[model samples]
Target chain A: MKTVDARGFSCPEPVLRTRNALKTLPAGEELEVLVETVTSRENVRRFALTQKCEVSFDETEDGFRLIIRKP
Target chain B: MSDRFTRFFASRWGIVLTGAVIGLLASLLQKAGNPPNMGICVACFERDIAGALGLHRAAVVQYIRPEIIAFVLGSTLAALFFREFKPRAGSAPIVRFILGVFAMIGALAFLGCPWRALLRLAGGDLNAIVGLAGLVIGITIGVWFLKQGYTLGRSYPVPASVGWIMPVLMVGLLLLLLFQPQFSEGGAIFFSESGPGSLHAAVWISLGAGLIIGFLAQRTRFCTMGSIRDVILMGDTHLISGVGALVVIAFIVNLIFGQVHFGFAAQPVAHSNHLWNFLGMVLAGLAFALAGGCPGRQLFLSGEGDGDSAVFVLGMITGAAFSHNFSLAGSPDKLVDGALVVGGISTYGQAAVILGILVCLVLGFTLRERFE
Candidate 1:
């Protein structure tokens, strides 16, 4: 699993970071992203779906943790 | 409902007052140093910025405008202070982007946005009157769509950090301006060597004026499209009255400052293509209507942390690039392709307006609650 910390980033940053993380990860590996904003969670989820990845999300105190598995 | 109009203005006087102040300051900026008929144009300035960032190669209109930077920052401060700052998105982001693109294309075709269009008319550019008419017509069409169920969708809550994208970009640009980093020979910051882009007030003055205007506009909700929209839709003249006040005041100020020159032939940074001016503004007005606000209003909304508005703004910047790159934008020298592009775009806009109205009518009849 590759974790990308994007908790404080805004708008496109979280998505951009997630894309970068996915790039470095091998196929079928999990990429976990920590994002603070609800928008980012939704965006990441949407992006994961578009990229044909499976996503499991859990809410934390400050934000949310999103794990995406590349297919 | 009666009080809604009154309350809107009461709460929004800040927008009106700031809009007027911006107008006055823009005039002053022009008088002092900026280009003629372009004291502070949001679309034009953004186009310059896009060029500065190497988005397009429009040599004649490229310069980084500080007023734009100040607008976002000032609005950000105001929103933060008022606790109205909410960063949200996902209201059909792609659609908003497309609207922004069309909006820029229309504005450039008309040679101005609604604010500048009005100012252009006030300054005796008769072409602007045509543009204004087209704007009104376009808004009327948009209102029809509103009467329908044509919404961009809903915005859900986003992280506070999501709102900082444009602000951070602005800061980065300001840093570039301050540092003047070595990029290329001949000051390739994409500044216009000798055109409309070359004309500008000093950076500090422009930024200061923009900040003040942004602060005031955020408070007033002063929107050119909304002014007409309210008056036509509900017979509420509050916003329209403020708009009228702006025109009269601007004219008076122009006269006092010896800026009101009569005749249209040699007007600064404008052309005498009356038909195209009308058509161009028609496209702009329709795009603004579909997008739900004028360019200035979009900027203010973005400042208040509206992601949908921000999307529209980015769309416009991209549209500016497209227009220039595709030769769809006009210039004082002559119309691009000499009337063909104008006619084609005008037809497309009109068709879109007609289609939009038809859709609205259908939705209005079908989607009503029918609470008889």
Candidate 2:
């Protein structure tokens, strides 16, 4: 699993980072994104889902950890 | 308490309320003595602040507007209270800065930013329709760029103190506003004796309004550019609904205050040049989209410790100086022998707009993740 720690960043940044990281991910590989804001979480999830990646998340103490599997 | 408050603001109605409040306050500010149809213009206010600081010699628009100073301070306070202040930087800072410069140039060419464009419409300036259309078209182009994996790279976290820079500078501006210190009578700082810079709401009232709006906006993440971008990219109307509320409520308030004068000619602080109005906002919209926020949103971001946004704001101030010094800003129409001579950008201003568009296109195309 590859981790893109987007903690403490705002919108577009997190989503953009997630997209960039997903570009190099091979099929069936998993990527995790750590974000500290609900806005970033939703945005990253939406972007991932649009790209046909399977997405799910777990709420952490401060924010959320999104797990994405590239198809 | 804070959790419930945050959740509420995240709800749809909360966002609408935020927009409505902003609309109400903006109209009231105009009625209270701010420039006509310009109660709260981030771009214009920043321009005035730039002139006040002697960044430009435009005497008619020089004042340390308290509202602008309070915006950064208010947002910083709100971010601190909410524990949302996260200082970060290093994401193609130069690109963002250049985008900001072009954004201001484009805005001055139209004599307004996105907020002022909407305000102009609400106050019955028919010229704003063209500007709004241009903004939409520009955002659509940016959306295309985003669809093609456009990115400005990623920002890394920095020390918390780094985030306080903008807030401290804002505080310094507040001090200047309070003291009005002079370095040999208009040699250092400048203030407008007449014109839009001289017209303003009371300082305390303006400060209060700025602080309130900044706080609410920070909490809700309100952004005009984001509203358009989200609608185009995600089919989301959450932010646009807020924008709609702002326009609707402002219109109603303007109607009640007798500020509605429907016309394209002789509108205060506005020109009647349809083509430049459209093209100017087109440049501004594209720059805002590329930079990831509108002027107001950038200020809020700076308040919350985004160094990249701070740099963008500085670029905007500098751009204002450039616009005035180089005669790239638009002029209001004037009555000549009972005929309205349509005002617009100068030849140099037109060229600047074209150059700005080309620069934005180049930046958008060259900064993509993959060139396939």
- The list of candidate 2 runs beyond 4 A from truth reads A1-10, A16-31, A36-38, A45-63, A67-71
How do the predictions measure up, each by TM-score?
0.74, 0.92
Best by lDDT: 2
lDDT of 1 by residue, B42-92 (tens): 788888888877688888788788888888888787667755576766666
Residue-wise C-alpha lDDT for candidate 2, range A2-69, written one tens digit per residue: 89887765566677678778999999999999997666886787688778999999988757999999
Candidate 1: residue A62 Cα off by (Å):
18
DockQ for every model comes to 0.02, 0.25
Model 2 interface DockQ: 0.25
lDDT of 1 at B85: 71
Give RMSD to native, each candidate.
14.1, 3.0
Q: Which stretches of candidate 1 lie over 4 Å from their true place?
A: A1-71, B1-16, B184-188, B333-372
Q: Which one wins on DockQ? A: 2
How many residue pairs clash per model? Answer: 3, 0
What is the lDDT, from 0 to 100, of the residue B20 in candidate 2?
Answer: 89
Q: Poorest 10 consecutive residues of model 2 chain B by lDDT?
A: B363-372
